[model samples]
Target: MFPLERQQKIMDLLKLKKVLKISELTEELNISVDTLRRDLNTLTKQEKIEKIYGGVKLVESKFAESSMDERMVSHLEEKERIALKCTEFIQDGDCIYLDSGSTTYQIAKYIKHFKNLTVVTNSIPVVNELMNSSVELVIIGGKIRLNEQSVVAYDYIFNFDQLNILKAFLCASGITVEKGISDYNLEEAITRKKIIDMSKEIYVAADSTKFGKDVTVSIASLDKIDVLVTDANLNKNMIQKFRKTNTKLIIAEGP
Candidate 1:
């Protein structure tokens, strides 16, 4: 594999396993020990990982946020399924808010049929997707977050307050029964919080993998979310936990 691809695989493995030995990485990548060592050294210098005695571990920090590219490739089918389900709640001429997230970005694909929908979003990808569509696109302009390709600024909070959003669709880095909805970036979380307050109804589009995981910042409580849209792979135990909350769950079955 190429060096960049090898490094991305190493990072993905580290995210899944937390820590991995050099031998394991060598076996997985089918590369020479010397080459893997060089790759690890480069990653270490970039502060993405730390070398231990015989292995490397991810730099576990509260501020560690995954890039848009990584998230886009992680759960492609599940996100698409959930996005399709989201269309059921949308109608022609409705004003809605779409957060800067991978799943929410997918919603743009299924919303093309809406003739007079007004979409307010902070995601650059979502903006590009609907720019030429019949829907009126409103971008939350502010400081651009390069990794996630979203905008966040304190001034934009007031802009959200001025609009009457019928529904706001969001995605989270993690979701738990207690901590509610959370994300890795504080600025994005703040932006989401503002949108949540402005909208009359709230919907969270999250994959099953996000359940039970608590990340750095909490956006809102479960009670604030009117509906939860996820893939059908969600287990019964998780469904029961969500049942205890005020948020109604919608399982998106595949085609």
Candidate 2:
């Protein structure tokens, strides 16, 4: 297989088992141990996976699962405003899952005050914010992606599968009425799809600026989103587009 094909397969395998031994990868890929190690090392540097003593493992986190710092700085204010409104869905004693992104990071800040809740996530920043909160914080163990400073892998999903998620707050790089929600990074896309699939009610926290954009990977349909929280700058026609579906859209006034 070509390098891209090989890398895709490796990503697939990581999703299945969360961890891979170098020898096992060599046998499966019909490559030398050195080549397999090289691949693993390259992926590790990219923050796609973690190189353990004798194997590799996927990064496990729910929020900002694969993003870089530059993207986080793009729309800080809009994200925070939407995140504040997204917190309305969170209640005490609820088990919440937050997918990582610049917007979702704000959601973390807004929900930290809820008592007796369990915040499950894979974002390093989210963990940093709520680590001292009264809420129960369960950090999913996995490899860390450097670009997004988020975590991905079956390891996180396996744990999320065991939980009863009350609300899942997600963020995306793109949200189109026709094409649905999208994200650029492959690692982020996989984890966001898993978040929407595994949660009971999916709450999307995004800015109005993201409305017409579409990206490489389609993670969720606009129809599948249970609630959308955004700042008040949304155009009227677009609001009608979301209204065409049963999805509940909530717009917040500027902060």
Candidate 3:
């Protein structure tokens, strides 16, 4: 792998494992010990990571602790662009599922432009956005997460088998070619898993920043997604990496 790509792989590994020994990094990256040390030194100088006695750990990131409102505005332009591109997949009279996320909430803003659409979602913000729109809205009911502004239908009583979700637009905290898609919350992951199983086409809407990252809960493998919608801000290297996978990627152009 190229130096930049190798460094990114190191970062990705560190995100998933939190900390790693130098030997582990060398083995995982298939690089020499000297090369691994060089990469670690670079990351240290960039203030993105810290080297321990024999291992390295990522620096604390503000993005990890951000609230729903903060996340909503974190990458506003890119999220908006991604959201608009996702709407192009929807057609009149389609039963679509919108997974709870800041990016998907932007999709709700364009709900009025469609005709005879049945919108199913777990996002409170999406529900509010479509409250007065002409499209029919169905909400997945369960415990509501105040910080995420999302509802998790974890109880067995809530049946997702009945819903014929034509297209599912999902969001993820982290997505990678090897690890697939993941989220920080388990309950929300459970809810998304159910919806994904029923949907004909799974469309994951995530900003470019989400790439090369992994979180706690595994939602599904990358192959399960029919298409991944991301903004043009995504690096070319990541795009090339994803192209090697089976999942189709759609890059939304910016203004």
Ranking by TM-score: 1, 3, 2
Error of 2 at 5 (Å): 44
Task: Give lDDT per model, in order.
Answer: 0.88, 0.77, 0.87
Candidate 1 C-alpha lDDT tens digits along 82-190:
9999999999989999989999999998998997899988999999999878889988868889988999967734455578889999999888889889998899999
* TM-score of each candidate structure, all chains considered together: 0.76, 0.69, 0.76
**Model 1, residue pairs in steric clash:** none
lDDT of 3 by residue, 1-117 (tens): 888898899999977767677889988888899898888889899998876556777775734633575566556788999999999999999999998888999999876779899
State the displacement of the C-alpha of residue 96, model 2, in Å, after optimal TM-score superposition.
Answer: 0.3
lDDT at 91, model 1: 93
lDDT of 2 by residue, 10-92 (tens): 98998877666777788889998777777777787888876654676676443333334434544566677788777777888
Clashes of each: 0, 16, 0
TM-score quality measure for candidate 3: 0.76
* TM-score computed on alpha carbons, candidate 2: 0.69
